[model samples]
Target: MKTTLSKIVLLSLWAATTSLFADSHGDHDWKPLFNGKTLAGWGVVQGYANYYVEDGAILGRTAEGSPNTFLTTYEKYGDFELKFEVKVDEGLNSGVQIRSHSRDFGSRR
Candidate 1:
């Protein structure tokens, strides 16, 4: 009975350790959304902001009189994981949108 209990405990420890490593270094089938040279797969909406590629980064500049604009992806996704980096000036507000949609509501009143 002692030997049997030892073997069971050892097996449990091995399984727990294996699962820890597996969860830490999970299977990540990630794909790059930006090509680092151009905005090939992106589109601009509302025409109130400007987006361009500079130094391998997509930059968005706010226009003075324009409304809120979006530089969005042309393709829609149901579930996804995204990683990004942003550097903005003081008091600048920026964000990333996921699982979103847009519709034309005619002229603004």
Candidate 2:
């Protein structure tokens, strides 16, 4: 009787743990926006810029003696919240514009 009860309890515990783990895995659904290989969906507005994929991140660098560079997403999003980390070199002249329209004549910031 004791052996049978212990086996049943162990089986029940294992089943519970497996169900919990499975449920946890099903709760997350995150989609990537960039394909990281080519600028298929992104739009380049102005300036001499270098864009490439490195370390699973989209990187844009302004070269020396280059004009102001702007990389804008091709897909225009409205009423949406986006969170990203912008790391600029110290004392680097960099500007980012979000939800702002550019000038058709000269690509104003």
Give me the candidate number with maximum lDDT.
Answer: 1
Estimate TM-scores for all models: 0.59, 0.54
lDDT of model number 1: 0.51
Scanning candidate 2 in windows of ten residues, the lowest lDDT window is 2-11
RMSD of 2: 19.9
Q: What does the lDDT read for residue 101 in candidate 2?
A: 66
**How does candidate 2 score on lDDT?**
0.48
Q: Model 2 segments beyond 4 Å from truth?
A: 1-32, 103-109
TM-score of predicted structure 2: 0.54
**Candidate 1 lDDT by residue in tens digits, 1-109:** 3223323333333333233333334664444556667777777776556566655555565566767666666765544443333334444444555567777422222
> Model 2: per-residue lDDT, tens digit, 1-109?
3223323332333343233334335554333346545656666566655655554445555555657666666665544334433333345554446687655323333
